[model samples]
Target: MNRVKYIFFGILTFSVINLYPQINRVMGMGGLTYAITDIDYSLTPYNFGGNPAWIVVDEEETLLDITPNFQNSWGNYRRMYDSEGAINYGTAFKGVKRLSSKGTFVGFTSYNYEVVRNLYRTLRKDAYTGEAYYMIDTTQGDFRYTGPVVGLTYSWEMFNDLFIGVSGTYQITDGLKQVYTNAQSIFREVSINAGLAYRLSNDFVIASNIKYSDFQETIEAKDVNLLDVEVYNYKGDTYFIGKRGSSVTQKLNKKRFEYRGQVYVKPTEKLSFAIIGNIIPEIAKVLVPQNSLIDVEEVYTDFYTIDIQAKSQYQLFENTLLGLKVGYNNKNGWSNNSKKNLLMWDWNISDFYYGLGTSYKFDFIPMLIGAEFEISSIKADSSKYIDSRFTNVSASNNRIRVGAEYELFEDHFIRAGFNYGNDEVDVLYGGSDVKKLGVSAGFGFRLSSAIYVNANVQYRKVSTEYGGSLSRGGLSSFITLRLNTF
Candidate 1:
């Protein structure tokens, strides 16, 4: 059997936040749910305050998946074992106004998490008499992820019908949790964003935004050969591979830019239509050099590209909105590793996703409810060097959101909501199914005509077959302040 698959997932699982630290990794419901199902609309709201009307909200922001998603990228902030529980936290907020020719806005966000949960890994080893038997589903140690982000943004109208905006940010992470080159590591990256918006006419507007980032990650690998698990033992003597998380595995110093343009038309006072297009540069990925792993000198690079989305939104009524999004994502990737040690294979992948949703505001209490459904197909080509374990992993998802916001007294507002979904994933060696639920509550205050503040708290839980055992969860709380001018 190829050690690539075994070693890859093994080492990769321990890799810090971003490498496995993904956009929605906590939603991986034991092959039952896809990471995409566990998504957050905002990172966290500590920098800005509440609003009677919040355009974004999600449950996973405070519910750590305890999977590689958060642990692989920014696992440093994790304060406890996530296997015993989880805490995913994040928020986003900004306020702006056209002050004659100059516009300015300030906002802040943060996302931190910690989760400890159980995993049922079906183990397989060649047995005597050429017989293969299943090993006991083992319970490994717990894991975690935590971090914070802060930023400021500004915009200026350069000319008639033209506008420019820029954003600067500072990020801090703790407990970086990825590993590459046989080492324990950490992950942290700082990035920038800018965008442009133009008015075609009184009834039309178009806009696009781009971002740049560079971060480091370090990885540390333990000598499993001496651990309690008999299955992982090798030679008696073991040495550390040094910390690779700072620059190995998932810790990528990326310089990618994603641009999107949208044109909105207001043909009449009551009806509005909008369409959007996206341009995503190729993804940049670099692997750990063998020289850093086992004293072997080698390095490699992998580049991939995709133009993943096309979407549209329409407003039938002033209080009702409809949205449709489709993605022709090509998770296709390339590889260029020349080292003849153990990490060389065809790194090709392609995946696609289709989604649709609608949101409405109820008149009674101004409640807002949105629901989305999606289907995905992510797969790889089988080759001698390719590990087909994950070939059959695929999934479908159905999401429903129910939320209500009401003005408590004038500009002050309160909100509460819930979310539910299911996902399935192909983990190469094995796959599982998952289901989850989220609960959230938030309040906002309009301090003045141009300033506002908001606070929110949320909790989430996931359930799946971990030897048919039930798992615990975590919670998150956030606050944000926003300033707007006219």
Candidate 2:
């Protein structure tokens, strides 16, 4: 009985968030530097916002970066609500500048366009909410989304051995479906973050950060064929009410808050370590339009998440470096019916990760090599109120990666990398028995004394088995140009 429950839980609560590839030159080397604690050699200045106060202490040079990227994927082995394929393309502009001896500023803006082909019954981007308050229909079609995002961050050394920073971002998107029951969607998001860091001594520093975000998505479906459109409003995993209409509208609103703290220690010039912890709380509400001015609340959900991680870096030798990382995360949430004032469903999930990596620079030649290994474990539990249905599940995954770079001559470099992973449970859709493989190659060129260019291309394949074997593959590429000014 427990095994059956676990299978169901895995099928219902699996999802993944797709993120754009980084535009840094180090990305060609399989991103090994991303896990290291050295701020001066990090991949991107934008990532410093994770500990916003680090902006003031970062010693990277001032520069402007322009990046253009594209990615595409297609497959048949997917979740019930997933799209058959997708294409994404975008461009971004980012900059970092030093205002004075004590102040630093960062800014970024980007535009993205996406096409989701042959999406299934779900009409919402997030279809796995335990509340089961989403809308669906029998028809499937392509959906298009386009949007622009803008953000700004500033850090200042407020006092001796103390630093403060603040950041804000805003994004808006518009989406439309191509076929009958042409659904239209509008999404808006806003976020703000603030943090402070203090140096307790020459060897230790502590930092804390707080963040808040608000999001809203409105979807409306309308048909011009003069035919009644059938829609299902789900109240649970297997139960839903049916309605026939020419048009319908719904809205989802979410608010979230996060608190984070970190401590960094440098006992010696050769070794450094950091420990970080985060807590997040979030709430979401589902509403249906009842009239021109009134809306009815259907479901309300409360969620909380906790995460902790430790990272360490050691210069094993004059030209060799070793890095280690360990992390754990837990998330739990519950949903209730607003009208009936009764609990509908609840779920909990936990994850653990371990990673080790090393890099070496050759003394006789202009070459660098790196290798990494990682392991992950996941567990989940869920319960539904109406049927008293409960489920529990667990899975594990392992990965290996290797990369190398060679300086062909002064100001020019070539890089290549390979990675493979095996999963007892698929990370994207929760299907069991999965294998993933990827290969990437890139080049970096110094166009002039103050300008540089970097480009990379990568291809990946995923194979999964449910009742039968299926495979999916995709290509992703990016080009970045940097202009440095003193």
Candidate 3:
């Protein structure tokens, strides 16, 4: 029971705000980064905001995107406990104008709102037989959290071949409730992006980009009722446990940098070569107090990470594409040692990842098929555990996806896909890994020449290799509408 309380607070302190655009079409392709050709919304070539130099517009245009998503899952505890669910709605606005022959300007903004809720259950395991059993469902009250995000970005060409961009974002979360606890959090971020692209000739183009960002987050929990829990261990002091309301505050700050270089060479009409390389580095610090009553009891954590990747793509027959990617990622962290906390530990983790992707379009019919496969090998320095218990620590996993689209009429399309993957960690009870399988179906319609809408639904399941699984999987659905103005 004490462990559960500690884990709950840890989640509230470490949960990071996600700001990436959730484009359903892109995710249907297994979230393949190396095979991405649509430069307008590709994060691999630039950063979170976008690449200023890559914006392409024939005339002045305004683009709008709206998406709503729903997700629910079970288990995967320590963060999202049992019966977890979320609903999110997001909208983005962008305006691009071709100012002159050598200059272009682009501006964009987006907002997202989400409602998250979950339930917790208690369980017991027999020591002699080592059999697990459930005691009570939702021993604690239902947990809920709500948040909203706002962001703006601007990019303009500074010179003949140089471009500059900047972005800012702010997020606030309210109504955060966990068991008998209530909390709130705030997040802020600012980033700058710069790039240079030069066209050597009509057949070739080379570009490079650099991005940097600073981020900060704060979480506060007040009037937390800790008296009813056994974790408080108040030394049998009834007055302090019953009358006092516990409070906690935590803060986190991070700085990040990224560099990307790309080259595209079109030697002939049916053949082309594309290559990209990326380097990313990040540093972060966290401050958390041991308890609310002690003013001087606190701990500090420092973390650092570095990542590098290279990808290449080849286009053949003008309608078929092949891509390959290789990458390495590493992270190291340390925290101040405290005697009161037995979980104080440091860690070093590293991994290697690789992937392959291919796609083809039939010339005789209006049909397209695409597939992607990826694998990751990870290693971590041994200890009780690092990050979270759900983390696989040292493991290898593989993922694969295939999707197809068919245009039955002039402006209507149908799409379908399937995916399978292995989880990062094995099942706790069975000691065997869990695998996931999913199927998706969707359609698209072109209302007009400038407006398009897409809707997709995915059904997924997670099951253990052996018997006696701990949880069920999730179901997700999303819809997107895009508007273009001339």
The top-ranked prediction according to lDDT is 2
* TM-score for candidate 3, residues paired by index: 0.72
Q: Report how far off residue 451 is in candidate 2 (Å).
A: 1.0
* Runs in model 1 lying further than 4 Å from the true structure: 1-100, 105-150, 172-186, 208-210, 219-255, 279-299, 310-313, 317-321, 341-343, 347-390, 407-409, 424-430, 445-453, 466-472, 481-486
lDDT at position 421, candidate 3: 86
TM-score of each: 0.59, 0.92, 0.72
Number of the top TM-score candidate: 2
Better of 2 and 3 by lDDT: 2
How large an RMSD does model 1 have?
Answer: 11.0
**Backbone clashes in model 3:** 0
Ranking by lDDT: 2, 3, 1
- Check candidate 2 and list the clashing pairs: none
What are the per-residue Cα lDDT tens digits for candidate 3 across 327-392?
787765544323334334355567789899888888999987888788988665522222343222
lDDT of model 3 at position 330: 72
Candidate 3: stretches off by over 4 Å: 1-22, 28-44, 47-50, 56-61, 75-83, 89-111, 119-139, 188-212, 224-247, 257-283, 288-297, 338-343, 384-394, 423-432, 465-467
State the local distance difference test value for candidate 3.
0.52
